[model samples]
Every structure is written in structure tokens, then in C-alpha cells.
Target: MRYLIYICFLISFTINSQESIDAALINSTDIKIDQIVALDNFETFYYLQDNILYKQNKDGTSINYSNYQLGEMSTANAFNSLKINLFYQDFNLVIILDNRLAEIFKIDFNTAQPYKNVSYVSTGFDNTLWVFNIDFQQLELYDYKTNKTRFSAIPVQSIVLSLESDYNYCWLLTENYLYQYNYFGSMISKIENTGFTQISKSNGHLILKKEDTLYFKHKKKEDILPINLPKLLINQFLLTNETLYIYDLEKLHKYQLKIN
Candidate 1:
């Protein structure tokens, strides 16, 4: 009789946990996606397919931008409605595009001084770029117009895993720690790492991934919310506002998150 009671309790606990997880996921939408990006304000989304970049609006209308000379786009960062920076890592070049996907300018890092190799790049304030100079192992604020380094931080010890930034601040994620810095290249905060494969940012919230599970936390808060996903291979994912986007090889899944 005691063994029977224990089995029943285990089943009840399992069902309750599943129910709790279901309550946090409100809705899900699936669509074919190759690469996905969300804007800073969480008001727009962009996806890339077959070397074509598409800007998706709330009404489902999309605008596309393509360049044959740029080759394949490696990464894109939309700093605001006016400026979007795209990088081609293989060619060591960066292109600035307008909201309509029109090209503004292109910079070749080989010609740009003080940087022989850049492992990562992100948009920064006043039409500048936050670049990780792999040769120096330092973070630098590079101005494209003047072709100069505005500010640079001291060399870091570990290799960078990922980087995220907005107009005012930049966040660097290494294997052992996460570092936050202001526009002046001053360290603001440092958080210890615990095995995250990828990281995404929106407002003050951070979404971290490890294996198939995701964890969300506010920069000012201590509590972390764990989100378990269905058994699907995730090629990439992004979080903006309260919405989460998970991408497989051929499809993208959008989910609304209920966070307390």
C-alpha cells in the first residue's frame, strides 16, 4: 500500500510541473526561417534567407535588401530605426544600411587601422561600432566616419563567446564571466558565468541558453526563470520584450512568455 501511494504522488508531481510550464507559454507561431533578428525596441523583426535580408513589420509586410558584392551576410545589428550594421566575417567588412535596406556605407577592416582581425562587431552610439579586436584581445569603440578608435578597454583573459549592445552600453560574454561596459569603455558590472551557449538581450532582461533549456533574468534582479522547450534542435533563438523566437533549420517558432 505504501509503494502504491508513492507512485501516485510521483505522477501527481510530474503532472503539476508540466502544467506549471504550460502556463508560462501563452501562444506559439511557426514559420520558415533561415536567420532571425529583433530590433532594440522589440517593435520589428528581420530574417535572412538565400542572401536576402527581409524586414518584417507587425502587419506582416516585409522589405528586402540584397547585395551580391557583400557575399553572404554573417551577422546584422539594428541599433535604431535609421541604422543597421551588417558584418561579413569572412571578408572582414561591415556595411551600414538604412531602414529601407539601402546601403549607406561599407568599411573594410583591413583598411581600418589598429585592427588586423575582428572576431565580433556590434552597433554603437553616434554611428560608431563596438569591435572586438582579436589580435589585441580588447574591446574598442571604433568610429567609421573618422576611421579611428574612440575608446578601448584593457585586454581580457578569456575568449569571447558572444556580444550584445545598444546605444549606451555593451555586454561581453566569455566562457567564465559576463562583462558590462558603458560607452566610455568603463566596466559597469560583472556577472559570473555558469555554462551558457548563447545570450540575447532586450531592455534590461537577458535570455541565456544551455543545451535545449533557456533561462531569463533581469539585470537588476536575482531570480532566474527557467523555460523548458519541446524536443526540437534549436539552430538559433532570440528574445525581445516578452516574446521568444526559436529557430530550427527550416522553421522558426515564436512564443509569448509570461514572466512574473
Candidate 2:
């Protein structure tokens, strides 16, 4: 694991640089959302409202799913568009949804053998899930079919803030640190979070956001570059592929993330 430190321009929590990257405004859409939920690669918007999960597509079509019995949806992972994982942390339950928003299956952690008190979950490779078992203080590659743990990472005593994973890697973000682990349960890199509040992966790169500035971390690069962005009210934001979506609760602004 390596730590790379760069000259971070911290002037009142905003990156001030003449050679800053440009975020070209592409389009704007008016949507009523508390926060920016997620905008998929296909330009589909996924939003959770009043216990119902809505999928609004670009073709003027939408679908929704809801289960009041499970309580509110804690999070929705649309990493795998074909199979979406909707987790309800309150009841430790997960509902898998198909592309058409149809319920495929449900995973109840309460009745699960071995009894894992999972606090976080995300889509994983080949019918598996990246589950953060709070009881064990570790992240596990869990296979729901066999109800077995494929691989478990080392325990972290700190509170896990966010978890993002691809097929080969799982990234765990804590209060002051961000860790990357491989499928073999090996820790790859441990980078200080440096005031970051959220984690989003797009095109094999990480787009880290703080208060008003956004940082970029390419997969092959060790340095974290601050994305030069204009000051705007960002209640929530999503960096998907070449586009960046910023929502101020009432409208969604789409921009192209052009890195210098």
C-alpha cells in the first residue's frame, strides 16, 4: 500500500487554481428529489420517494417498486443494472429487482444461517454480494445461493461510512480513511480520506467529493487531483462516466467532467 500526497490548495475549503478542469453544462432537468440519488450510465434516474423506488428513463418511461413492510430503503445499488439490490437496513432485508423493476428474490438476514448482522450491501460478481457484516466488523463476499461467505476482509474497528465494489475490488470508506481490498481478502491501498464525505465509482475511477470541491482518482494513478469546478449549490452529485449530475433538490444539472 502506498500513500501519495500532493499540494492540496485549501483556501476556505475550495480549490483555487488557474489551470482547473472545466465542467461544461450539458443540460438540466427539473426533478423533485430530496437529494441526487443516482443516474445510471444509460441516463436512467433512480430515485427513492415515499418508500417507493422509481426508475425514470430517458424514453419518457418509468417504473417503481415498494415494500412498506420492509420499511424505508436505506440504499439502492444500481451497479448491475440488470439486477438492482435494494437494501433496507432497518430490517436487515434485501430485495433484488430485475430490469423491469420486478421482484426477483428477497434475502432476509435475520433468518439467514450463520446469522450475519449485515449493515451494508452492494452488487458483486456472479450472483454474489459485497456484504459488510457489522457483527464481525468485516466485509465479506457473500454468495446468497449457498448462503456462504466466499471471502472476508480483515476487520476494521472504525465505523464504515461507505462501501463500493466492482467485480475484483471492494473499497471501504471510514471516517478518516479509505481502503481498497482485492477479492483474495488482501488490502491493496489505504488512503487517508482527507475530508471526503462520499464515494462514487465511474469508469474505473473514483470521484471524491468534499464540501464544494470534487477530486478525481484514476485507477492507474496514485495522485488525487482536485477537479476544478465552479461554486454551485450541490445538495448531491453523481459522476457517471463522462457526465456529472448535480442536484440542488429541485433540479438536476448535467455537466461533462472534463479533466485537464
lDDT of each: 0.79, 0.81
- Model 2 misplaced regions, further than 4 Å: 1-20
Stretches of candidate 1 off by over 4 Å are 1-23, 39-43, 222-224, 228-232
* TM-score between candidate 2 and the true structure: 0.87
| TM per candidate | 0.83, 0.87
Q: How many steric overlaps are in each model, in order?
A: 0, 0
* lDDT of candidate 2 over 83-153, digit per residue (tens): 89999999998999998989898898899998889998987888899999999899898888888888888
Lowest summed lDDT window (length 10), candidate 2: 1-10
> Residue by residue across 101-183, what tens digits does model 1's lDDT show?
89888989988765558889998899699999998998989999999898888888997999898887898998888888999
